[model samples]
Target: MQAQIENTAGKRLWIKLSAVAVVVALAVGGYMSMSNTHAAPDVSFTNLKGEQVSLKSMRGKVVMVNFWATSCTTCVAEMPQMVQTYNAYKDKGLDYVAVAMSYDQPNYVVNFVQTRSLPFQVTLDTQSKLADAFGDVRLTPTTFVIDKQGNIIKRYVGEPKFAELHALLDKALAT
Candidate 1:
């Protein structure tokens, strides 16, 4: 009955592994749920023009802090809509900061902006400090819409939703 004993031992090992996996999954889910409810971190970084920008400076305006990369297709696709949103609300003190995570050099970002004709303040996260500060962003095109009081109103980790973004801005403006 050696074979029978070995089979039973293997089943027991499998069951133990499954239990550990479930426990880990539950812990991770709980951590993420709690983290999502908190306000985003406040961090400062430099724009392509060498201007130091922080969340504090944009305090009285609805700010869109977008994390993107030159190689990300989804980030490129959202540029036009971002431009539209900026144009529509810039007069009302809306600010858009496109923080490039991949290409840190100013020339690279400047060229990208020039080629795309993107109308917004393009910045560089040289060491990805801002990205790390906000969250461990593992994907491109992550965005955070901060309200006038510097609170993170909403966050999107993928392609931007213009309607949701506009709604947040509208609410911030109304207040």
Candidate 2:
């Protein structure tokens, strides 16, 4: 009956693995739904070009506000993908603003922006007020996708899946 015992053991292992897969799927779904549906707080910042931009004025467009620090390794690693995502969506009414965390030095932010030749607007939150308004963001590469209705729809920490981001932007811009 050795074959019978081996078959039962394999079935038990398969059942355990299926259970774990279900649990992991549920956890990921929960995390995706838990981003608080808050109205994006009113904020403004001058871009690297020194022109002031207010969130209130961007109400009719899909906005992606990304908080990053120059020294955050993940943030640095994700910059090129972020730039590509913005470029792909900007013409479709996506308004992207990359904000530097206050603790990041101004000269460093400037140099990074210049060296990278980032295509979207890049602002510096020198006072940290913007971070406070955006839920006291203390993490690097925090991203929020705000729909045209001004509701914060998606919040991503670390790096986002660019393809998923494109799909979200596509859905947002269609309305």
Candidate 3:
């Protein structure tokens, strides 16, 4: 009878410990999900026109920062869409900046911008500081969508689907 009681007590303890473990696991999971999105680093960019633009100043606006290189075909192909996206949302409080990689020739970028008549801000990362600030971005056409609150909402490593991107922009702008 004593052995039976001891066994019952042990089983109850085991169940209680298991419940505590589960609760802890759930709490950790929730915390991780909540902390997934991080704030964008504060950085300044010099546009082609030699105007200084700081990310901190862009607060309260949905900003799109694209890291691109002139030699990248994909970057070239998606630029038109980027222009369209900027044109579509610029008046709705969206700010866009295209950062040419440090390796890209300034003349090439200037010529491309002039030929295309790109309306958004075009900046050159000549010292690569901007790239390092943006998570050491090495791939061409890497894009980051920052929410109005200055948190990085999404990152696209390659060409993003325009439709989905538009949907995300619409949702973000609505708020």
Candidate 3: tens digits of C-alpha lDDT, residues 8-85: 999999999999999999999999887677889999988999899999999989999999998999999999999999
Runs in model 3 with CA error above 4 Å?
1-31
Candidate 1 segments whose C-alpha is farther than 4 A from its true place: 1-37, 103-107
Better of 2 and 3 by lDDT: 3
Give all TM-scores, in the order shown: 0.74, 0.79, 0.86
Per-residue CA lDDT of candidate 2, range 1-175, in tens? 9999999999999999999999999999898668546799998889999899899999999999999999999999999999888888889999999999999999999999999999989999989989999999999899999999899999999899988988999998999
Candidate 1, run of 10 with poorest lDDT: 33-42
Quick one: best lDDT, which candidate?
3
Error of 1 at 11 (Å): 38
Model 1: how far is 86 from its true place, Å? 0.6
Cα deviation in Å at residue 114, candidate 3?
0.7
Q: What is the alpha-carbon lDDT of model 2 when measured against the actual structure?
A: 0.93
Candidate 3 at residue 104, lDDT? 98
- TM-score of predicted structure 2: 0.79
Off by over 4 Å in 2: 1-36
